[model samples]
Target chain A: MKVVVDGMGGDNAPYAIVEGAVQAQKEYGIEIVITGPEDLIQKELDKYDYDKSKISILHASEVIGTNEHPAMAIRRKKDSSINKALNLVKNGEADAIISAGSTGAFLTGATLIIGRIKGVLRPALAPIMPGKNGPFMLIDCGANVDCKPKNLEQFALMGKAYFETVMQVNNPSVGLINIGSEEEKGNELTKEAHKLLKEAPINFAGNVEPRDIPLGNVNVLVCDGFVGNTVLKTIEGVAGNIFSVLKEEIYSSFKTKIGGMLLKSVFSKFKKDYDYKEYGGAGFLGVKSICVKAHGSSDAKALKNAIRQAKVFYDNRVIETITEYIENSIADNDENIKAE
Target chain B: MKVVVDGMGGDNAPYAIVEGAVQAQKEYGIEIVITGPEDLIQKELDKYDYDKSKISILHASEVIGTNEHPAMAIRRKKDSSINKALNLVKNGEADAIISAGSTGAFLTGATLIIGRIKGVLRPALAPIMPGKNGPFMLIDCGANVDCKPKNLEQFALMGKAYFETVMQVNNPSVGLINIGSEEEKGNELTKEAHKLLKEAPINFAGNVEPRDIPLGNVNVLVCDGFVGNTVLKTIEGVAGNIFSVLKEEIYSSFKTKIGGMLLKSVFSKFKKDYDYKEYGGAGFLGVKSICVKAHGSSDAKALKNAIRQAKVFYDNRVIETITEYIENSIADNDENIKAE
Candidate 1:
């Protein structure tokens, strides 16, 4: 299978993106199409030796920066790296697409260009994050801020299908993020969504409190984009604050400095485990084709992993599974409504 | 000034509650009334030697539990320690009330029994939490789950008043907690609330993203109870997970153990600074009288700090100031409606 890569995306740009594309193509045995200015991409690719036939360059003249308006940029920058890469997947020239570019621009381009699955209501940004027990998926991290109950129901189904296929967890348990653990607790959206989730065809673990999210009790956590975004950012904020505090304390005195020196390996390992780069990227689930948005600051290793993630998404037919799930669930709901 | 303490509250009750009361009375020179079974409270109070005239006991046989429904328990358990303590404030027998009991019960009792201030829309739980730079107040942490835009506007006002009077910050900045920083970048509720906040009398700092919360950018962060609760708990969950992971890494090997031992003091100090006990307790804003809800598992030190917070609230006439602010804002809103 062939996967398209945005060669002029992220902080490391052409060098890291080219290297990662080459690494992924060699290791995963997938054809890679890099999109950007041809000369710069070729210069970066020349630094590495790879199978010439497996890696090809598709030159795109323009680039989308993070600061530009997402929808407006996607509409205007037709020749941008992100736009070109998405078009490849849309036209069936590539099986999947990976970009470490502006998340908003990438998501907007993918949805507006490639389109959504037949039965899907909305595409969600599902990020696999490290938890106390293992990793879990937080769906609708920031895709749609204002959501209806139907939207959250779709998020749960999409999150479950994506987690089970990409993460390889069978019949993954899905939990609705709420302020309280009871079914009756939550605002109007979550309260109604909780009922729908209980009736959905997935393992519906009831309401999950925010305090229990880090424990990794469920494989998939579903919520509206507003709440999901807040939770995701709050976790990052708290972790960043704690690490900063720990660093200050460790360097405050001579005794702590020696202690920090001795535990250097331990700290490095812990940081590696919690790093966003290790998780590759967040998948824009419900899109017609596989689309992955890597972190904006991703390095070569992160981009490589993101390509691997895209390969898995394409191979497992995650989009088809989500479509089937949504179609069947919607049919059943229609039948229930008719009966009532 | 006189402060009433719920002697039968919290996990370490009447021992911790009684001791904390005596400590507050001795340190702050405020008259303290401990409400619970007279015999049990007296037994705990006997351990401390202090001014006899400054402390007294109020006999209340029943007790409200954390497991009980907040509103129902408040109505039925009239003689409970929490109920009696709230009544003392309602009747003007006490200047303020401190409870380490069930948060829900205390908040409900305070609002239902003591009543809300004139022109107050709703009472809110405002907690002072440790941030990177200093402490910040998260208003409506878990009071009203489903809130209108007006409720959030009032929360910003009450939060500003509380922070200024008790924390002694002059005209503290109030920020609306949202997924994005832009005024137009939130859900319907936040979008409308943003407009109202900008027009409100408080020092509106526009929208603050969740990622910037721990940086202490705003003195008061306002949101609906559902979002506020989730943000507060997510911070706790992430911090707890990080510390647990760090502990596991530090204990995994012999070298790390030596490092951990040497850094024990630094770790202890960091933990102490981040502890909830250091900040005292959350205040129930908009209540007619001062009402502070200490953490459920509060120790004597925590409870004493809660009493200290109540004393500050009483001395600063926070309720009076909030009432005036709400009344003026409501009048201005009415006038605006008329002009339109």
Candidate 2:
């Protein structure tokens, strides 16, 4: 299997990207194609020793910055690293593509360039976040801002498919995120989506409130992008705030400072549980191929893990499974609509 | 000024509620009317060493539960403590009402009985949560399941009025909670609300992403109830999960257990900062009369603080200010529409 890596993306750019790609090639034994300015990528590649034949470089002169309009930049900057890497996947030169760049640009480039799966309304940005028991999937995290009930129902299905196939969970539970867990609760979109999700062919776990998300009661949590983004960011904000508070409190006195020293490893482990690097990257499900968007500040370890995540997603044929399931469900719904 | 207290509300009920009322009367020198079974309220009041003349009992035989339908229950159970308390405010027997009862029932009773301020489309549940710098208000948290652009615009105005009056923040910054900060970002409702808020007479901070909420960048965060509720609950969930995780980690080893003991005070101080009692209760803004809903599990301290909050709200004439602001804005819009 082959994977295309964006070599000039993210904060750590060429160094972390080149090193991660080399590690993935050596450990996973996958053919790797790094896309960027060839000279820049080569300079970083020279710092690491690896199998030469297993990795190749593709030159792309332009780059997409964080401030640019995502869709417009993707269309205009065809020679950008993200676009070149996507082209490799489109032309069957690679089975999957990974980038740790501007999330908006990567999402736009992947959707418009790689295209959507048949019968899919819109692709979802599915990120796996740490929960009490384990990690759970949050689907449609800032992909389609305004979504109809149908979009959320499909997000539940796509999320379910991704969880079961890639995470290898059996009959993963799917939940519709809402203000309340009662059937009649939530906004119009969630109320309608709840009804549709109950009838979808998956392990529907009723409505899940945001308070219960961290408890890991459900494997797949589905919502429109606006609500999903709010939940995701709030979780992040709270964790960060708590850590900052802890850092200050832990140094307030001599006794507390000594206590903090003794519990240093404990805090480290706790922080690791909530780290984004541990999960690698978020997957853009309902697309034609495997596409993963890593965190913009991802280090070498995170990028390497993202490449592994992409390879696993490709190996499991997740895209084909989602396509088949969604097509069948759409057809069934169409027939039901006709009869009604 | 007189404040009505729901003695038969919340988990702690007559004991905590009655004691809180007695404490408020003693500290603030405000007349307190407790609503519940006369005999039950009197028994709790007798346990407290306080002046009898400052406290009075209004008989309420029934209690609305968390499971009951809010609007329907409020209409049917006329003698319920929540309904009677709201009736006191509506009847001009009390300047404000404080309840730790079912949030849904309290919101329903307040809107149906006390009514909305003239020209206000909907009342909002605005809660003050602890942030890094201090506390910021989150408006419309589970009050209205769905909201239009106009409703959010009004929420922003109401939130601004509350923060400036009760919190005494001068020209408090108001932010429209959205997935992104860009002008074109967010769903249709927020996109339109953004435009309306920009033109509204307030310190509009444009779009504030959820991540910035904990950083206390804005004094007031406004969103549709669904998104607001999700953000509120997610922050609670994250804090709870982190504490649970920390408990496990701190007890994971003998050395860490010793560390935990030494650092207990630091942890306690940190927890106190985020405690619900510190901020009193949530304000039901845009109503004709002041209505404050404390946490359901509030103890005496929280309930007492909630009463103090109601008194401050009443003293500042917050209701009158909001009424005047909303009425003027509505008139200006109607005139603008006529000209167009």
Candidate 3:
């Protein structure tokens, strides 16, 4: 399978991105197509020799920086690496696409170039949270800010199908994140979404509070973009703060730092468990091609993980399962709507 | 000044609540009125030898537990301790009210009995957040489920006045809590609130993220009740989880437990610094009288802090300052609206 990598994105562009592609080609036995300025990409690739036959170069002259707007770049920058990489996956040149670039840029390109499945509304990006109950999927983490109740119901349906296929959970429970775990807890959108979710022929667990999120009380956590984004960011902020404090404490004194050496291996495992890079990036589920976006600061290791994730998406037949579920669910919804 | 205290509130009520009232009477010299079942309160008080003349009892026959619906109790359970305590403040029989009961019950009573201030569109419950730079006021921590842009603007005005009287920070900087500090980030409400907050008379910083909260980056943090509640709860969850993990590590073995004992004094200081009880209680601003609601599981110490907070609120004339500020700011808004 051919995987297209965006070599002109993220904080550590060209160098780490290109290195990751080289390492993946050697390890995974898959054709790796690096997309960026042909000269710079070739120059980076020359620094390391991998399996020559497993890698190729795709030329994309233009680059989108971190400061550039997503939709603007997608519309205007014709030869941007993001656009080129996504286009390769759409036009049967690549099996899947991966990017460690601007989230907005990658999502914009993925939506416009790759397009969505037939019956899907807005595409949602679900990040698998590394929690105690394996990894729970939180959909619409920040894709659509202004969501109707109908949009949330659709998210739950897609999320359930993804977990069933990729994670292999049998009838995974879907939950709506609310203020409290009661029928009458959330605001207007959540209140209406609760109704739709209950009747959507899924294992709906009603409402789940924020406290239950880290505890991994449910498999698929659903919410509108506003609430979902805040939840994701809060977890990120708290986790980051804790790590920073732990790092300082581990090095504040000679004794603690020495003690840290004794526990270095242990701490490394802990960091690995919480790291988003290990999750193989957040998959854009509703898009036609399996376009996964890694964190902007992804290194070689994270890029490898993102590529591995694409394989899981392909191996588990995620796209075909999601298509079938969406068709049947929409047909039922249409019938129900018409009757009402 | 007369301060009404709920006798039958909290997990350890009557005995602990009576002890707290006795301590407050001796320490703060404020007349304490215990409101609950008169017989139980009298029995608890009879066991304690103090100046009985300084304390009085108000009879309330019914009590609501944590499991009861807040709205149903407010409508049906008329003679509850919370309602009676609030009524005392409403009728001006007491200067303020304190309760460590169910939050929903306390909020219900405060809104229905104690009443909201004049011209206040929505009354927000402001909580004192412990930070490195002291406490910053986070209004709308969990009051309004659905907030418009105007409600956020009101939170800023009330939070500004609160800092003036309580924290005594001159021209405290107000911030709209958003997904990111970047200008174009956050949901629709925050984007709209950004414009209004910038025009506000108080020192207005544009947008602040969740991570910025602990650093005290802004004096006031404003958002809708849903987002605010999630942020607050998430911080609590993270802090609690980390502390527990550390505690287990420190006290895992007998030798480590001995080390913990050796550092017990230092650890106690850390516990006090981290404890929410030391920060007083949450204040129901924009109400007629200052109403401080402690945690439902409050011990004697948290109750004492709430009483202390009430005295400070009375001494600094918090209500008057908030009233004066709101009058001036909204008048400016009225003029701007008329001009347009």
Q: Which parts of model 3 have CA positions greater than 4 angstroms off?
A: A246-269, A338-340, B249-273
Looking at model 2, residue A257 earns an lDDT score of 95
lDDT (tens digit, per residue) of candidate 3 on B1-340: 8899988889989777888888878899889999999999999888877787789999999898877898788778889998888888889899989988877888877888878788787788788886655677788978888898988998899988888888888888998888767778877888888888888887988888776776676888888888888887877766665556557666566655554454454445545645888887888888889899877777877888889899999999989988887888879979999999
Worst 10 residues of 1 chain A by lDDT: A266-275
- Ranking of all candidate structures by their DockQ, best first: 2, 1, 3
**Ten contiguous residues minimizing lDDT sum, candidate 3 chain A:** A258-267
- In model 3, which residue pairs have backbone atoms overlapping below 3 Å? none
Q: At residue A163, give the lDDT of candidate 3.
A: 92
Off by over 4 Å in 2: A334-340, B334-340
Candidate 2, residues B1-340: lDDT per residue as tens digits? 9999999989999899988888888899999999999999988888979887889999999999987888899999999998888988999989999999989999988988999988899999999988888689999898998898999989988988888898899999999998888888889999999999999988999999998898887999999899988988898888888888889888888999999999999888868877888889999998899899999999999999999999899889899889878988988899999999
lDDT by residue for model 2 (A1-340), tens: 9899998889999889998898888889999999999999988888889888989899999999877899999999999999999988888888999999888999888888899999899999999998998789999998888999999989988998898899999999999998787898888999999999989998999999998999887999999998888888888888888888898988888999999999999889878888989999999998899999989898988999999999889888899889988988989989999999
DockQ-based class of model 1: medium
lDDT (Cα atoms) of all candidates against the true structure: 0.90, 0.90, 0.82
Lowest-lDDT window of 10 residues in candidate 2 chain A? Answer: A236-245
Q: Write down the DockQ of candidate 3.
A: 0.44
**Residue-pair clashes per candidate, as listed?**
0, 0, 0
lDDT against true structure, model 3:
0.82
**CAPRI quality level assigned to candidate 3 from its DockQ score:** acceptable
